[model samples]
Target: MVDILMATYNGEKYISEQLESIIGQDFKDWKLFIRDDGSKDNTIHIIDNYMKKFPDKIELIDNYNRNLGVKLNFGELMKRSKNQYCMFSDQDDVWLPNKISITLNKMKELEKVYDNKKPMLVHTDLKVVNQDLKLLNKSFFKYANIDPKRNTLNKLLVKNTVTGCTMMINSKLRKVISEIPKECVMHDHWIALVASICGGIGFIDIPTILYRQHGNNQVGANSNSLLKKLIKHAKDFRYRFYTEQAEILYRSYSNFLNSKDSRIVKEFIQLRRYNCIKKRYVIMKNNYFTNVMLNRIQMFLCC
Candidate 1:
């Protein structure tokens, strides 16, 4: 059975539709586990009503007295998962009818190739839509210029191509990421990094989710021009931010990492102390760059 984990906050507006879509999935052997991050809105009331209707299929985690933010909220839910496969769900995005069947089929294919004991992750593309469910972009990967095939540890460390709501993980990966660190930029990025270093990552080119974009989205797709994105990254880039996360990865899984991965992680953490020219050279020599050229240039200039 698959355990679908969802983290909710003040998402009363679109959550009902999202839950309805999940309930209408073609795949039937799954239970939805939801945890509220102290929503003051009618989100909890809606969830409680759903619970009364689908007691066996939907469950509300009882430890909602305090707020744990988004990352920790999903982290706690993942730790409580006891199924063979787990998929992260947003409180707002609508999953297509075949999402579970397709993702689970890919997961099974990956397990056959890599063996079930190996940590594995399967993620797909998404369709970007406006708050009114109108099509904003047909493909989120293309709309955002994200290359999902860049699943290497070095590339993922610089930028995350995997979207949490489009991802599914096997039991091995769920156990490997038993706890998410506070230094993690996002839960999905951290999980992708661990999978890249430890085992394999599978990608489906098809879009399985209607990725909703709204004013309240925590992190939505960016349809900005190349120049605009360059300026934004230049203004927001923090070398220390990336290094701190790498440091935590090294600290947490140094023993599990292979020699080359260990070296890459160490160099990533140490590059912060290097001179500007040397830092850029190290990034180039080690191939520690993202798939996007503008973002790579921004990293070269800012780091």
Candidate 2:
């Protein structure tokens, strides 16, 4: 009933554990579409062995062994995805047995309300864990302060609370994200923005995966203290890239945005194109800043 798009890259150390986790899922109506991102290690071997064991449920994408970074690989996965719903998985994280069932349950419930026509996204919180799988935090949302109320089009311009590994996106969102412009940012961020603009986001407060935090993690969580996060968000250099990337998303999908969202994005884009006082005025007059005050000030400093 669901297609799991898993991207692997040199994950020999924990591939078996991760695959076992997936195989142990309480929800069995799922297929694993593995895409190896040029793993120099035995990652592919491990996945192949698993595919051999579960040929009916798991298989590798053909001629896709080239290294395309996680974002584009996932975008390609979306394009090739075949199912009513799709789920993303990391090569190393150990998912809870209930991960697929819980996410799919929420996805189905949300689609029912949206009549399955709108782009709906369902994501759960995660239990941050260490390399050895020791539990760190129970809820990633609480540790990261990921509030669903702030997941609007404007707020998504600054922050992304929707972690891909814990998300199950419907076919509508899968198709929408597959066609997102190349200039857009990461797949998860682009998906969140698309969900906000096209349909809606459904968040599960429960942790669905053991989000590992190994030293070699490509993109790990920021489990810093709240004060540290605020100070970090208040830095001009920090927001420059995010602001620029947000501009790319706006520039690419402006027409897809609603009138209000479109105007805000248009104004922000036009505002940033200017120099001196006009830029500052635009920043002040606009409501596109992040939900936090310090972050807004930091973005202002960026301007």
Candidate 3:
């Protein structure tokens, strides 16, 4: 059985469609816990209607408590999950009927290998769609040029591959997520790094949800332009931010990591503080860096 945590904020436009899709999931044993983050819209009203329609299937929380934002709202719900597995849900995306079934099956397969003692996380790619629910791409990984092979600790330190809506994590890791530090970024990114260090990290190449890009999203995918990334690299201070995340992860989760991973993390932290020459030397000596070409260049320059 699974507990689905949804963080809602002014999602009135697409809330019902997403709710309906969840209602159609082949796996019916799931319990949905929704926290509306201060929506000055009909989103809460719609959620209430759905709760009324499926009293046994849904539990609503943070009714009028606005301004919690996505991170804290989801964090509150994650802590209360009493299920073997927990999943993250966006109020907008439409899940295919088999989404829960397939994700749960893959989680089970990973559990078979990693066992229950280790934290387990399994996420799938998504079908990118426009506001009208028209397909923009068949495979998000290909369309975005994503390569999952680089989902390692050092790589994940800078980039997040585990999209929350498509992710299902075991209870053990859910507990860790509930305790994530305030300085941490998204729950998915923190949870992914935790799983990479302490347990099983699995991926499903096929998409399980329709990822909507409605242009009014609270947190949508980054702009898909090399030029924009270059611009953000300067304007957003992303290099420093990524370096901060790497430091926070090392400081917070060092105990969960093995000796080698801890060393890699420590080396990366040092590399961030290193000058370009020293950074390159450390990377050359320890190879404690990402594998992707773009990310490698970014890391090299940032370091």
Number of the predicted model whose lDDT against the real structure is largest: 1
TM-scores for all predictions = 0.96, 0.89, 0.90
Writing each residue's lDDT as its tens digit, candidate 3 over 1-303 gives 899999888899999999999999999999999887778889888988999999999988755556866777777888769899989999889999999999999988878876667788999999889888899887777666566666788667656777889989999887765565556677778888888887768999889999888776423337888767655543532545666667888877777878888887787676557788887676666544443455556545563
For candidate 2, write residues 1-303 as lDDT tens digits.
899999888899987998999999999999889888888988888888888889999988864548878887787677767788999999889999999999888888887887878889998888988899988778776665567567787677667778989888888877766664555567788888888887899998888899987876624336457666656656633444555767777766677877888876666556556775776676666655555675556655665
Query: Clashing residue pairs, candidate 3?
Result: 38-66
Name the better of 1 and 2 by TM-score: 1
- In candidate 2, the residue pairs with backbone N, CA or C atoms under 3 Å apart (3 or more residues apart, or in different chains) clash, namely none
Clashes of 3: 1
Local distance difference test, candidate 2? 0.78
| Candidate 3 positional error at 10, Å | 0.5
- Which residue segments of model 1 deviate by more than 4 Å? 216-226
User: 47, model 3: CA deviation in Å?
Assistant: 0.7
